[model samples]
Target: MADPVSVDVPHKLGREAARARIAGGVGKLADMFPGGGTVEEHWEGDTLHFTLSAMGQKVASRLEVFEHHVHAEVDLPPMLTLFAGKIREKLAKEAPKLLE
Candidate 1:
């Protein structure tokens, strides 16, 4: 895989509140995808682990929640490497809202 893209999204809600908000907003994101997809999510202590598979591409991500920030690491499939910038931009824009 290409080097994983890392994004640090800051939130003012504090870790617990931010974690709750992110978890609740995930279902809304499912409806925004162009085509239907499967998202499998789990938690490892305070970190959230997720795998999103759609249109033959898979993105595995881990979000580490902290008091004032959430650090996200996304592993994009090789085929999707070229779109990394767009993907990062989208995440950079949306992550904060999700955490809020």
Candidate 2:
């Protein structure tokens, strides 16, 4: 268990537009990893709750699409925590593209 990794990407798109763009790309979240994985996605109002399981690690994440930004919080396993900074950095860089 490790602390959650939080990343935010600012966007000019409003909530509806941002949400639509994010919804379309979220299905491919698993593909970003090497071995790929299954994602169980659930939505609660404006927030997306997703669990990614791959290579014996389960990463539970919450993503919220706001009017001005998208925010993500990933709960990584201990093994993955070592790379949390890198993961946060990458997410911050790529999330905005999804909104566009």
Candidate 3:
């Protein structure tokens, strides 16, 4: 089995706001990629746990919201690096719009 490749991406948003935005984004992604996977969200204190899985593979994202920003760490399959890259690109482009 391959080790999961992790990527950390930070977003500029408050804790609650970041959780809302990430949940919405995950919903959008699920809608766009139906049957591709399942997305789950949960919060423990200030940390938000988000996960997507399919075909025995999983992508996990942990969001830690600080006073000034939200730090997100995404772990995915090594073979799916391109897909992850695309997600990062999309998030970089669309997150600000969603936050606004």
lDDT (10s digit) by residue, model 3, range 25-61: 6555433221347778788887778777744566666
Q: What is the TM-score of each candidate against the true structure?
A: 0.88, 0.89, 0.60
lDDT value for model 2 = 0.81
Error of model 2, residue 36, in angstroms: 3.4
Per lDDT, what order, best first? 2, 1, 3
Best by TM-score: 2
lDDT tens digits, residue span 72-91, model 2: 89888887877788788878
Q: Could you give the candidate ranking by TM-score, starting with the highest?
A: 2, 1, 3
Error of 3 at 86 (Å): 2.1
* Candidate 1 minimal-lDDT segment of 10 residues: 27-36
**Best lDDT goes to which candidate?**
2
Candidate that beats the other on lDDT, 1 or 2, i.e. the better one: 2
Which residue runs of candidate 1 sit more than 4 Å off their true CA positions? Answer: 29-36
The sequence of per-residue lDDT tens digits that candidate 1 reaches over residues 10-89 is 88889889889988876544332234277789988889898887457777878899998999887878877786786677
Clashing pairs in 3: none
Q: How many backbone overlaps does candidate 3 show?
A: 0
